[model samples]
Target: MGMRLWKDMQQIVGAGFTHDTGLPTWFEVAKATFLQETYQKWLLYKDDCVKMIETELVPQGGLFCNRTFDRYACWPDTPADSMVNISCPFYLPWFDKVSQGVVRRSCGPTGIWDEDDNGQVWRDKSQCEDELEVTAQELWLKQLMVSFRMLYTIGYSLSLSTLTMALIILLSFRKLHCTRNYIHANFFLSFILRAVSVIVKDTMLERHWGREIVKHSDVSDMLSHQAAIGCRIAQVMMQYCVLANHHWCFGEALYLYYVLIASVFIDNNKLLPYICVGWGMPVLFVVPWVVMKLLKENKECWAFNENMNYWWIIRCPILFASLINFMIFLRVIKVILSKLRASSNQRGYPDYKLRLAKATLTLIPLFGIHELIFIFATDEQTTGLLRYIKVFFTLFLNSFQGFIVAVLYCYANKEVRSELKRKSHNWRTEAVLMCCGQ
Candidate 1:
């Protein structure tokens, strides 16, 4: 049994041993003695080893077993690797919630302590120092934030490209410059800017990828300090664009309602007021928000405040716009149905209603109705499947807002399609004429 134990121990540590393998430490002898229960004894020895690592491995001491022992101080097996509160003795300030001063070094597959890139065994002190990686939930949340940013980056890029094309198409055609199209164009422009701002914000936050927390009392403060002025500008622009997007959609709904339901006093051609409300009104909300945040919070940037009352500067306007637009939508539907019924064309009502439904669905992103659903979409009570569903669904809908707007308003618009066809036909005709002349 003794010979077998010796051979087994030799096999495990032999490759790392030097010519001067020296006598085994008391910890190693303890480990060798309880060979039948090597696992438990090693764990106890590991704990004891740490307790006396400085004394045991001193040059004058006789505890050295092998050169491998020089690098690795033995550590006990943790019940859960993820929950281990790893600390570093080299650093000061006892990390909060670490439960005493010691760090949790991982017990590796070889039943030895993990080593650093330099071959020096060390615990990941960052895991304790950085609060972001402290808990499983927090780590997952951090990853989810990254995923959200990635999703937003891709989605908004598509939206930005499409929106720019949409603007070009609208501006290229003078005929499509009526109140509704103008409002749509304004909405597109707002979202385009919003997309750009969000992209910039994400870029500035790229350093947070490695689980390092950006320390600040607030997100606005973090942005202001960590990032350049462009980040703050982008954050402010996002706020303005978000508000402009909402207001412009409201303007669109109102214009549609006036044209369809109450057009007697409404001059469709005089849309300067609508344009002002769409483009200019957002400044009212954004300026005060910036000023207040600067004065009161010394915020991270012009980022959203957690308080609903504080956010009331932007939220109240957006919410009011959404409510008003929804009301206009319902009123428009009622008027359309009534007109059709009075004309004795009940058969056409279903098709008209279906079209209206599609129109309403498309407008949901524009008017910010989808945002209301997000209020209840928090992962507070969620776990596992539900949490994933809530996060993914929210991200898909929220991040892809600009894409959805582009698809519905620009790519799918009848006027845009007709304009494209007309341009293509004229181009072909000009080409043919030039060929004939040649």
Candidate 2:
């Protein structure tokens, strides 16, 4: 047994234990530490199992099979042509269930352990895998995650297309170069960049970080220096873009609030403050989060936020922006309602209702009031049907945000529509004149 283990260790370690092995990289050193701790713990477990198996009874009757150990569980001697049952092994590292069940192994008539279809000793303990069984809840969660990914993918793709067209309209015409439109252009660009970043992050995680957790996998895929850095960088970029995107949304509301309160045209010079808030502010928080992660919790591709304080570094800013936007919306709504009541009441209630609905539609995305729907939802405590609804709605809101903003601000704006119409009419007239002259 000792010789066999030593030979197996040599085979497993290969040239790793040899004297000629040079200095390894940080990843390789970490890999070596993991392997060493794993093997040492495994050896200790094997010893404990062997010590417990020593007291098992031997076969008493004639024509009986001898006792055997299969490195995982020890089988006691049993009478020929019969089955034996023993307590399930507790030392299996992969199994976490209680060791109360019995495992049955057969002794052949020829006084040998019965061979399985693969011609090897077999034992049945299917009832003992608490950690291995995929429960209905787990299956449901997996399906839900897949569906959410699909939903977000579609949403981001649509947003990308619509936002691109909106941005082109904002930029192509020189007349649309006011402070407000420039702010609109920045908002569109932020969402466009965010959509692209999200798509790339998802792809990189699936490919580089392993889409699914595998069982009993080998160490060959454990330490890829490139994939590790790539996925972490992707995560960082996604976070930065997310912060920038949210800040830009807040910038939209800020500009709107300013315009409403000042009741005057904003100077192009005022655009710089909005740009700084939208593009530059995320760096302050993201840098600290990244530094803490690198120094404290660097594992798992910097994907998990096991530390809530660290996670709040990103969440707090977005929440603060949302809260401020909500307050601004309340004031803006007061102003809007006052104006509507003063101007549209003489036009009749039906026309007033139509204008109010239009204003509500525009304000929801503009002020990010729609996001307050999910603010109180804690995904961890949710269960059953409500959880599904919340998750789906949250994904829906996140995925289609760019599209909603583009619709409310650019595609649905009167100025944008008029500009497009004028441009089209001018191009058609120019084409007619050239044709006539030719």
Runs with alpha carbons beyond 4 Å of true place in candidate 2: 1-94, 97-142, 211-227, 263-269, 345-350, 379-386
Top lDDT prediction, candidate number:
2
Model 1 spans > 4 angstroms off:
1-99, 102-147, 207-230, 302-308, 340-356, 375-394
Cα error, residue 427 of model 2, in Å, equals 2.3
lDDT of 1 by residue, 99-156 (tens): 3445445545444555568664545534333232356875675466557556756777
TM-score of every candidate relative to the true structure: 0.62, 0.71
Q: How many residue pairs clash in model 1?
A: 6
* Per-residue lDDT of model 2, residues 382-431, tens digit only: 67788778867876887798898888788888898898999999999999
Candidate 1 TM-score, true structure as reference: 0.62
Give every collision pair in model 2. none
